[model samples]
Each structure stands twice: as structure tokens, then as C-alpha cells.
Target: MTSQNKSVPAFGYEIIRDYALSTILGKHADDVLYWVGKDIARKFPCSDIQLIISFFEDAGWGTLSIEKEMKDGYIFQLTSDPDLLNIKNRKFRMEAGFIAEQIQCFKGCLTECYDEKKEKQSVVQFTVKWDTKEKIG
Candidate 1:
């Protein structure tokens, strides 16, 4: 199918992603979604940050940007149109998990990601940290 045909409306996407999944999975939704995101990353791995950014856009997640870099980790910001930004109680754990897995693959180390929701600013910030001492073979 063409990209346009494959596209899903924001409301529809939200209904499934936020509402349906939460309703079905309940309190476990976030954790399950996080692992699902990691599985997706493993299936469609991105070797570079640019590819990751492109993936986010193509998936209609949002605009992903690097906010800061640290010795052990990096900070990322996600922003979207008003439709998504205005969503009530939207969680970004999936996105965080995706980034964590991607970075772990890239850095060959154990990595974890935490997300902060800035509802007032309509933004989500992710902090990705890796354990340099624990390398993956």
C-alpha cells in the first residue's frame, strides 16, 4: 500500500495506542509496550541516530531531537503537533524503551531509558544512560 493509504489518523492512532492498549493491558500496558518497542527496534534496527530520527517520523511518534549529551548518556526531546500534544495522560515509555535498546545496540553496553512528560510544554524528554563498565559481547 502507498504511504498515504497506510497512514492512520491521529485520533485513530491514539485510540488504539493509548486507549485500547491501556484498556486491554491495564496497569501492565506501559511495561508491555516498553518491551514491544524494544522488540520493534530489534526487528528494525537503526545503525545511526539519523535513521532513528527518521523512524520516529515515519512511525508518527513525533519529532525527535537531541537535547543534551553526557559522559554516560544523552537526553532527547520529543515534540508533536497539537493533536498529539494535547492528549491527556499520554505515556512515552515505549519510545523510551525503544531508544534504550537502540543505544544499547549502538554502544554495546547495558542501557536504560527514562521518560519525563512535560504536559504543560507538550513535550517528552528521554534520558538514556548506559553502563560503560558492562559491555556486551
Candidate 2:
């Protein structure tokens, strides 16, 4: 099998990521990672909202689903099995930031995203909002 096709241990990746954010990044890790996520989103542009959902699944981030849609923005829910629930909040910020940036870039407008963690449900809810009138990026 190709090196790129090799499967990585999820625990190893998680611990490394958590360590980098906690030890290396320190208090500002969340903000830094959020912007980093936006940069990543810009690098990998998605054509549509559905593609965003697929991206999440393909990346092993989570199962993304639309919880609600509004004129200004959308609400998405990310759910995963209980076994994958050990990730830090900072890691999730990366996801929220990525989705925000992708939507903003796609719509050519300013977009902001926020996430709510439902620990009991093993779910995260992301709210992405954008200004309809200001379509310039």
C-alpha cells in the first residue's frame, strides 16, 4: 500500500494535537487554531454545502448534518460515536473555523461561526452566520 494510504492511529493523532495546543500553543491556542482552520478551508475550497458535509465525513472529523437554515446562515450538527469523544475543545474550534471560512469564501461574504458542545449527546452544534447584503469578501 502507498504511504499515503496508511492508516494512522486516531489516539496518537489526538494526543499529539492536544499536546501541541496545550503545551506549545498555550492560552492562545484556540484563537491560533481557529485561524489556522480558516486558512485550511481556503486552501481546500468546496463547491457546495453538501460537499462540506462530505468533507467532514471523509476527513473523519464527524458526521455533519444541517440542523437548520436561515436567510443569514446555517446551523450544523457534528456527531460522532462515543469512542471518539475524547478530543479537546480547541480541536473542535478548528472545525468550526473551517466551516465558517469555507461558507464565507463560497458566498463571497463575511461569515462567523460558533460551536456548542453537548457532552451528554456526544455532539457539537455549529452556528454559522453571514451578512446577506455584504457579499464582498
lDDT of 1 at 108: 96
Worst 10 residues of 2 by lDDT: 82-91
Q: How well is each residue in 1-137 modelled by candidate 2, as lDDT tens digits?
A: 88647767988877777675668888887788789889888888897899889889877787999999999999999988756655343357888889999899888888999988887787889999998878864
Candidate 1 per-residue lDDT, tens place, 12-84, comes to 8788887888899898988998898898899989997888899998888889999999999999999998577
Clashes of each: 0, 0
lDDT of 2 at 12: 80
Clashing pairs in 1: none
TM-score of each candidate?
A: 0.93, 0.90
Off by over 4 Å in 1: 1-5
